[model samples]
Target: MAKKVAHADYHGPSGGWGSVRALGAILRREGNAGSTALALRRQNKHGGFMCVSCAWAKPSPPHVFEFCENGAKATAWDLTSERIDPAFLQRHSVTELEALPDHDLEQAGRLTEPMRWNPVTDRYEPVAWEEAFRHIGQELKALSPDSVVFYASGRPSNEAAYMYQLLARLYGTNNLPDSSNMCHESTSVALPKSLGVPVGTVTLEDFEKADCILIFGQNTASNSPRMLHQLDEAARRGVPIINFNPLRERGLERFINPQNPAQMVATGSKRIASEDHRLRAGGDMAAMVGICRLLLDWDEEARQRGEAPLLDWAFIRAHTHGFEAFADAVRRHDWAAIERRSGLTRGALEGVARHYAAARNTLGIYGMGLTQHRMGVETVQMLVSLLLLRGNIGRAGAGICPVRGHSNVQGQRAVWITEKPELVPLHRLGEMFGFDPPRKKGLDSVEAAGKVISGEVRAVFQLGGNLVRSLPERRLLEPAWRRLRMTVMVTTKLNRSHLVHGEIAYLLPCLSRIEIDRQASGPQTVSMEDSTSCIHASRGIREPASPHLRSEPAIIAGIAKAALPSNPRLDWNAWVGNYDLVRQAIAATYPEWYADYSRRMWEPGGFHRANPAREREWRTETGRANFVAPESLEADPDVRIADGEVLNLITVRSNDQFNTTIYGYDDRFRGIHGSRDVVMMNPEDMQRLGLQATDRVTLIAAVQDGVHRDVQDLQVVPFELPAGCAAGYYPECNPLLPLWHHAKESHVPAAKSIPVRVVRQA
Candidate 1:
């Protein structure tokens, strides 16, 4: 039924000579081959710029070369010599530029000055900073505050995020949606209800003490490469690492530390996982339920045998509620149903349970794989329930770790960049800032897009992100974006969002993380919080790309001054002149966590924010951690299909990509080269569908929305995946995801699993 072809597989270990070669190539491509070495040495170190890559933690006593290959790419991307001046903007029309690919659009270089769209000429022309601010002010004054949306990427510093939120609140709106709304909003919503904390409880040091590590739906090699070192060390110490995912990611299989010369040159590599379980996409919840059922059964057997019970009864009685109800719900789930939903046999799930029960302290780490589904909230709660069975919370080397993608995404939420007003301290903000903040719930990413389509939202203020490319249903959102009355983007480089501009769109160039941000006082330092809740100082070592570029704080202040009425209570100029004033305000607002912020920021490795869950102090309504249960074994019952030709599609990112930003065409780890327009499928499924390797096909969504959503001209590649399951690159496959298909509670787009039918091209 199928035609056979030669398979291209990568046999090398992760982070060996391949990574070194990739880094060298990126440096040369960006024309930073000479000065990049010094920059790499200073990255993630004290008194140096933080890596603008992932939110992986840094060691206290940092290594000389603490950065990874992707980190090198990000730095080179920021420090590239290419510049987009007025002449460059004038040379190409908006229609002409929109035809270029995303990578080429970004490669056009960094913005050199403020520019405004000229509808008459269909091109962007340079404008003065003062004039741009005045026009933005006038436009804002004309529209209702509720009709404007303020969106931020995860790249902004804590001080900038705090000021940006303050500006929005002072303008009488709570519409502060951010990057977190798209990625980790499920974690934010589920963790607080389950653990009494919205963030992870474990620190970087926990890896050393963890007896067993359970990773779900995360690719360390591609998403967070710096975490490989911790896994390598844990494996060397004989810790059991049980990984659960549909794909056997290279990072979780074996790792060769580039920092270790002996390991790099050796033929062998360090084994990272003790066992890798291939579960179906969107089956994380089912697998968790299966493991919990086995643990409950084992506990009963141990109790009947007059031995110690497997579950932590003491911890459960003391620090948790609703355990009995959760256990009862687990008992109701049948093995046949679990196996059918999870695509895992009972024996495999038993092995996972055995590993989890054998260890005294276990750690659970997850990413978007679990959170980008329809039942994302319930799935996260199930994982928390699995950990609570053994009292994993608040224990050394044991807790939940939600590996965030952006460096300061969690920190942005910490500084009140959220739609839910109750999560922030409104009373304190009002008393300190001398204004009453809005109480109405604001719009999230999905809600904002829907409102934009309906002509409810008239303006958009983007801090720093390619919002057009990142959100789902790009085919619909891109055209609706142009309907806005005004759009202002404060960014470092050009992106697809710039081309899909509004009637009155303005682009304001700003300093990046690796560039100097000097104020009237002296050289200023910005703070970022890692995924581990560790906040540290980051200072730039390179000069600004353009002399006209301003810092994020300055740009926000300029707009605030021009838009709102003069307020004696707030000093915008002083905050911009000395960043310490902004830090002081942050310390005053969140005294319990950020008191003496400036002094603590200068510490060796900075300081960890206080988490009540880590201290066994429950902040939930019941005054204890809660054990929540899912209603069924199926994660997405509404979209489940029984048809043989229909497959569950999981949108993935390439090794050369981060979020929506594409660095190169090669995913060296997956053996994909020259293009990202391919779909990976199981060989058996290809044969069943009468398809072969290199066959051209189109993926059509199986939804009943009456809208035909399909991605055409995708080459099918046979890979190691479960039957009836397929994988495709994200943002490319994002078109097949309906705007209405999102998590029930969190509103995050369900990009991980979409039911699709593959139609062969003639």
Candidate 2:
């Protein structure tokens, strides 16, 4: 039967899912509204003003049309049509709300008023602002502050994040677990150890200057389509792009820049991928090892011929240490060993090696597609290792770009998250507040989830992010959520994260970034740090969605006031009244680019934070750069492909979707619309099972480890794929992602490498 469509009331799949992030994909998806504003602000402020949504940025003055279909859709998702109000929740029971699908829950709208779960009614009821504030304060005051879990999302602005950390520390706990813990914790944890910078070294400008771009594990065309235009420009200038991923995304295949009327009015646009490779999902480390092996061999051959070697030997001697140890480790693995595991031919590896050997400036760009596996950290380490192999870290056009997911996610970490004692930010937090902070290392996302599961953590306060869907194990996570004494969500929009209320829950509505602030400060502009470590001001160009809505900062201050009424830990009202004071506080603590942040913000293009690498200064302990080889290649974990299972399922995002948010299902990129239950699989796998494309099949995720996960009535379709592999979209398949199945060092949930068996259950 054909579905009936009502005018202005048509319904289908809401295409909202941000980056895979740590939960789904790496920094490889659409940007949330906050992320969009942050990216736009940076682009309007600087040279590499790239779109965070889909890699659409113009080095030569970026424009709105520079963004792609997904980018626009991403923008729309941020400026959503839904509204979350007190009356909405008043009408629905807590259990009933929980029963709604993830998409339905989010589509209901932006949060309008502060709400608390009424124990008697078993439903969330609107609570007065004063009552809400008092309830929060009483709860925090009752518990040992150290036991309270303070969680922040990457989506939160730097100012909000700094304040969040400040409030937590002043209250006396270092449990500052946030979104970074989920996605790039390894990047955060590894890079400081690897190259002394936990963030991407390459700015948006680097994309235009690089001679060769090797994008591994990143599906930029779909994930960040805006980036494809840059690659298109690089291709026009005769630069090479070596793309590596499991699936051949259409976005990477080609791009038609609408901004160019010649191309837009005519047929197709510019091409993106000159050469692409699809490695086994978990085999990036091994694939990279092969490339390194090839480089070393080429270097030796050049030396034998009395020719200068390909490696920047001078740079290594003056800047890097531990090369000898790293070289020794690379020597242990032979070419064949590298190929067998990586599923790449020896020539494919050499082709990449040859390009690296010749290109003066090579940017190794990657997304979460690389980091969400058992070897994700190793995969990222391998990419960084590639840059280090040839002195690419601190160069103008050469570096490892992790392509951060959230807008202010990098910004949040800038002043607040991963607090370092050496930095003045932490010092000022202590000095200004007159409070002693806990010096212990705080729990990360995975560890926090583990803490919640183990019943060590009691309460959870999510600043702005979907905590439940964002975590690894849904079954474990759902129950763990219920165990909490309280779960407070401060969000502008409604999402499944708010629905998964704890036994005691509070929902607070906050101002959207697009809104104007008419506070006592007269008018205020918010500052955010972009991927390249540049701090710029973000002023809302549009009116606020609601007259009653408060800014996120104001909402957070309200929470802080609720948590601590006596002495009011950090002078919440004073700081929230004017964000500049927060900036001055930031400047007082971290005197780098923010020395006179307010004055500097008035200037065009904002200020770039000081990175020693940018100045050709080495911050390593040896006073030199170091390149260490990975101890081992990343092997595909043992997900037994027994007789019953059809193929190993890999979870992916459709072009229309961001991470977990549903705008309305229309994946314009893939030409798939209306539904998301369809699967893309290898023809061989389906043929063996006597099933064709679109055949209904139930994926029984009996992952041999005794963990059970399943996807029922899945419609499988034949697509281009390696014999053993298959692909399906996410959240539908999110359950298949086992909690224990994560990168060894980085507890980033292995959404890519699911050790599951897929089958046709009639």
Cα error, candidate 2, residue 171 (Å): 1.7
Against the hidden reference, what TM-scores do the models get? Answer: 0.98, 0.90
In the range 1-762, model 2's lDDT, one tens digit per residue, is 111211121121111122221112211232244544444344333332223243222333445444455545544444555566667776888778877766677656566677888889887777887788788888888887655778877666667787887777767777777766666766765666667767778777887789999987776755666666567789889898888887766667666565566755464455667788877766678888888877888898999999998888888788777888777888898877788667789888888888888899999888777777776776787787778778787878888777666656777778776533443255566676676666766666777788888888888888877878877777777877888888888877777777676778888777655456666787667766766676766565445656667777787777777776456445778888888888888887778657888877555556677777665576667676557677877534655444544465678886656666655554444555566776677777777768875567766665656756776776666666566677777777776777777777767777776655556656
Q: In candidate 1, which residue pairs clash? A: none
Q: How close is candidate 2 to the true structure, as a TM-score?
A: 0.90
Quality of model 2 by C-alpha lDDT: 0.69
Worst 10 residues of 2 by lDDT: 5-14
> Whole-model Cα lDDT per candidate?
0.90, 0.69
For model 1, residues 313-411, the per-residue Cα lDDT tens digits are 999999999998999999999999999889899999998898899999899999988999889999999999999999999989899999999889988
Candidate 1, poorest ten consecutive residues by summed lDDT: 1-10
